[model samples]
Target: MNYENKSFSIKSWAEDDRPREKLLLKGKSALSDAELIAILIGSGSRSESAVDLSKRILNSIDNNINKLGKLSVLDLQKFKGIGEAKAISIITAIELGRRRRLEGALELSKIASSQEVFNIMQPIIGELQHEEFWIIYLNNSNKVLLKEQSSKGGLTGTLVDVRLVFKKAIELFSTGIILCHNHPSGKLQPSNADKLITSKLKSAGDTLDIKVLDHLIITENAYFSFADENLM
Candidate 1:
């Protein structure tokens, strides 16, 4: 075989420079994102090593892993040397990473106060451009049973049903519930609708023997707590 015709492979590279080898020697965290992707791809075209191709692929998406994770198999196959198998490998890895994140969040099952609730939710809903309503169910000890999104709507408003909220709390055997939502406009002040909903949910919770712990209005930079303000 002509030397020029030989495709580049990770095995031919120096041990420390090869993705798999480097991973073994320095540990997985020591590898770059492209190196990790290259290990997944396994091979590359005649002109490029897997690492080079992986770098090119990431660059195409501006190195944004979230955008790359959203790619379909067909979309990935548009790149050279990335066929059906490689595309599947990439997508499967991305999905696993996403699941791990959700699992980590679930592991943080206990919450103590409104500020703790804010810390947990700030990252999830703080950056959204629209309104979202969430209910967190807690046991008697304030251990979080589940966090559920109750409603999502446009920039101006979101509709949340009180019945659905209590139903979920009852199903979870929760003793307390925390209500939360975001104001995309970065206004922390609660609207009249906000006041009315807070009153309605609190009343319903009381009748059902479930305590309404707090209602928080969140924004990108600030938050308002109804309980802290003596409105609850």
Candidate 2:
């Protein structure tokens, strides 16, 4: 028997072992990360099963789903069994999950602390390779009105148009605004430019009676708050 070139199809597995059947019989939560991904890819190459291929892919990223989500289509297609379609399926699923999380975070009607701001903004810009500036517009009672991306830039920094920032704030009748931007470098410390921008926005907000409640420097895992540190 030439086992070297054999293909192990998912159908050969027992009902409980097949990723799709396992999900239908047990539950989605019952499936391992690789099993779920196996469902996405649907099939394997001549040398392995979909589950086996998924495991190998996950292992390449140390089994971190966040890292997996960051993989581009080209990046994923480099794997043995992952072609363009399978790679797209993985990317699309990851993106949908991210949007679901973002929607859940936005359900926070009222902003209470800097942590809440992070929860709302992290999904929008946290994992990016570039920088994005966002403003969280709030009513007098701290209830969120809107979150708008103010600008985008490269890995180093982004330009913020202070006039546009307050223009939307005024239009929304927002009494307060939270400034936020991501540091893709994952450094939580506010840089000199960060401080300067915060100062400029806070000064502008003061004139219009729109409070700059906090300015958050967001990263993938953590955040820094200007107000919390009395920098505001």
lDDT of 2 by residue, 70-141 (tens): 999999999988899999999999999999989999888999999988988999999999999999999999
Among all windows of 10 consecutive residues in model 1, the one with the lowest summed lDDT is 98-107
Q: How many backbone clashes does candidate 1 have?
A: 0
Best by lDDT: 2
Distance from true position, residue 189, model 2, in Å?
0.7
lDDT to native, each model: 0.89, 0.94
Model 1 TM-score, 2 decimals: 0.70
**Per-candidate total of colliding backbone pairs:** 0, 0
User: Residue pairs in steric clash, candidate 1?
Assistant: none
Report the lDDT of model 2 for residue 96: 99
TM-score of each: 0.70, 0.94
Q: Can you tell me which runs of candidate 1 are displaced by over 4 Å? A: 1-6, 113-134, 149-158, 170-173, 180-232
* TM-score of candidate 2 relative to the true fold: 0.94
* Tens digits of lDDT, candidate 1, 16-126: 999898989999999999999999999998989999999999999999887687689999999999999999999999888766755665667687667777777766676
